[model samples]
Target: MASDSSADVVIVGTGVVGCLVAERALDAGLSVLMLEAGPRVDRWRIVENYRNLPPSMRLFHWDAPYPPKPWAPHLETRVAKESEQYLQLEGPNARAYLQGYVRYAGGATWHWAGICWRLTPEDMRLKSLYGVGRDWPFGHDVLEPYYTAAEYAIGVCGPSDPALQWPPNAERSKPYPMGPIPFGPGETRLTEAAARIGMMNLPAPQARNSGVSYHGRPPCCGNNNCFPVCPIAAKYDAATALPKIEAKGGKILANAVVYRVETGEKNAVEAVHYFDPNKVSHRVTAKLFVIACNGIETPKLLLLSKDDRNSNGVANSSDQVGRNMMDQPKLFAEVELAEPLWTGVGPVQSSSILNTTQGEFRNRYAGAMFRMENFARSPLGSAAALKKGLVGKALDTEIRRLSACTARLTVEHEPLPLPINRLTLSSKTDWLGINKPNIYYDVSDYVRRSAKEYTVPRLQQLASELGATSFQLSPEFLNSDHIMGGCIMGSEAATAVVDADCRAHDHQNLFLPGGGAMPSGTASNSTLTMAALALKAADAITAQLKHG
Candidate 1:
């Protein structure tokens, strides 16, 4: 083993949250080190990989370009046999909990849709106001400034008008850095159709350049390939920020899978142990440590690092490290409209109906967010046509017809945090000889009741408003890829892993910020909230260093 390495601060995982924290720390004149579990990937390489995919795999294999390393295996959703080897799942809704995240240098943000939504004030105080789900340690007001900072950091574009803004009443210090992306024909038609039912469809705030360039990124050209990989760098991804951090003198180590966190005097984290691809081990020491890995991997790493003083885990004094897992349970409706709506023209998603996101009925049932999916239908329609044994002209005609008339609408419901839905280390080991993660997940009655009683009926109603000839709702719930609530935050140490500032209760110098620290899943994409929490933690760390 090499002699112990040291730095002013060390961050694990190079996702959006991790990069943002590194930027903040480096700006504060602290020597920072970033440890990434996956290899450094480039844009052209990922684009080439996408182009090489077989036609059958091109439609849904978003993680194919960023293949998982043997030593650091993330869940592979494309191949069923290989995916089952990485994660051991058991629960009533176990299959629905399969998540697709990349372990590459920039993490899962490489393939995200870039929709950014801020949680409402009511969302943070769920328990006190509606008698459900645990409340966040602080309300939205405390995190609002951080949200604005995160938006600017990521280069978001949204409407300046309050009527088109999300959460319409959210407190804003200024307008978005760039104006909102124009609505395409599909979105315009969907917005009008939704209004007939007394619902309002608002423009989605996204992390993509709208008109002129900002932060050296070009404006979006509307190729509609936001998923899998963006051919152009118009969309914001952590990979774009990595170079900026390095330019500011931050050091990054790739393919270094951290396995153990060493605890020293007073149970403070002194160093962490990681192994290279060649199985060579090294130790890194730092004054302050931040684990910005996403919800699942963050807690999994904590539970893996067990010591004599902390037999359960490093930060598991309250045994809440890998409990209270939450994700937005999703359902889909595929409908064939009587008229051709021409459903694909711009981004994969641009607008959504916001009426059902909150209400007094939340005391009884879960709330949901609904959107019309804007993915191009040619690939899916072609596959279906081939399955029906059509050929040549018949196949081409059917593909075109389906591409123009078919529309997919999705409903994502907020799930209450349940301790029973948890993650644990499996006896099964990976290529690196480390234990695999096992998950026990259930959408719970809170989401199920909402689906059967409210969401499903409303979905049918929307399809009717569009004059659909054939409409079918998926029977099983799906994962929205918004993993949250593993190392949850709260005011009480007995039930939480982190505090309002995202600092671990047991280890003052350790911070775990991101979706894992989120106490509530509010029926929206959790990336913006995760970034906001990271900014808040960064401020706290900077203040502590100043006092010292």
Candidate 2:
């Protein structure tokens, strides 16, 4: 292997977690090198791609705008070929695990909605409080300061009023960097309805500038194009950090797929091997290695790097590297209200009913976070009306009515980490001859019971509150794309892959921080938690390099 480069810290993946870690390492004066598996493209190009997409593809196919590179393939669910898919999914709830993330330089943040939700203290102690799911190694207090660091690092904007905060009165080290964005008409109506029902529709803390420039990026202009690509650099995608990271003396190699993790004495990670677009291999040695390749890809890479010293793959001494796959199991309700709600006027998602996220009922089943999907319904309304063969003024009237009246209600349930839900290297290989990831997933009875007995009724009640003339609930569970727990963390090395600081139990220098290391999938989005873990891991890496 050609060992042509080296660094103080080598991070695999260029997602928010990796980027955050890279920034922190550079701030500590450490030489950092990041390897991204996918091609990097300009933000304007992605915006143009969305504008040119077919109306059908542009509506909900978030990954439609950025075409995947052959060597760094991600699942293309809209594609006709099942045989060529990179993720081979199986089990009864396989479709629910069909994630919407991409293998691009910025990772899924390129198309994320920028929702940043922190887990309640009770959320990390599921096994102790709820008698289900694994408890995190540390308490929420230990993670609290890191959460604050992550918020400031990502430039999060949120409500100043504690009443509007999720887990009202939850302790915070510092206030959000900016105040919350104003709600659209639909969100305003829903917030009032939620208050009537004894619930709180809190503005979601988001990683975007409010009305002024933050962290050298422009504020959101309410273009309602957060997904696919933010036309302006308003949202905090890791792609935007690439230039700043480079400016800070951090090196990032795009389209360099790290396939094998090479380990040495005392089971420490010594180097990682990657393949260029042309299939030529290169080796990069570093004092420390951090893998922030989301949930699926992180575990997939670990399971693929099997060696004689660690036959089950590095950090898989307990056979837990690729187990406990999770995502927030989602169910949707499409409701047509009697009054015009006028959604889609701002960001795609701005608020959610977080009160449902915690309760004593969690002992029996999972808790959930409910939200009104704020994406504009106009495209869907027009498509449906067109299919009805309507034209002229009649068509226009129906389109306007349906667009203004319809709203998409969503419920995402917290998931228990089950050993049965796992990802393994498949016989199927990609263009570079690396085994594709095969996953077997089941939302499990925890999430299912929550949806069937608890969340579904709540959705119906919210629909009634909206004065819905008609409503339809989806029959099957959907993927919220908040992936977590493939490299489950805990105090015990027997059952977990990573420790309290997100360092691999078996490999001292290998840090796996992100959704994959989370022990519990809290009902809200997991990106903030992942970012917090990354920051915490970065601290650990800095201490290790300085002291060890």
Which candidate ranks first by lDDT, i.e. highest? 2
For model 1, how does the per-residue alpha-carbon lDDT over 1-548 read when each residue is reduced to its tens digit?
A: 11137778899999999999999999999888999989998999999998898876765678777788898898876678877978788898887678878998888889999999888889998999999999988877788899999999999999999887877777698789999988887788888888999778888898989987878888988878788877787889999989998999888889999988889999999998899999999999998999987888888899899999889897888898989888999999999987777766878877788778899889988999989988788887887888899989999999888887889989999988889999999998988888888999999988899998999998888888887899888889888888899999998888899999999999989999999999999898999999999999999988887676
What C-alpha lDDT, on a 0 to 100 scale, does residue 158 get in candidate 1?
93
Question: For this target, which candidate reaches the highest TM-score against the unseen true structure?
Answer: 2
Stretches > 4 Å off in candidate 1: 1-4, 388-394
Q: Could you tell me the lDDT of residue 65 within candidate 1? A: 75
Clashing pairs in 1: none
Worst 10 residues of 2 by lDDT: 75-84
Task: Give the deviation of candidate 1 from the true structure as CA RMSD.
Answer: 1.8
Q: Report how far residue 199 has shifted in candidate 2, in Å.
A: 2.4
TM-score computed on alpha carbons, candidate 2: 0.98
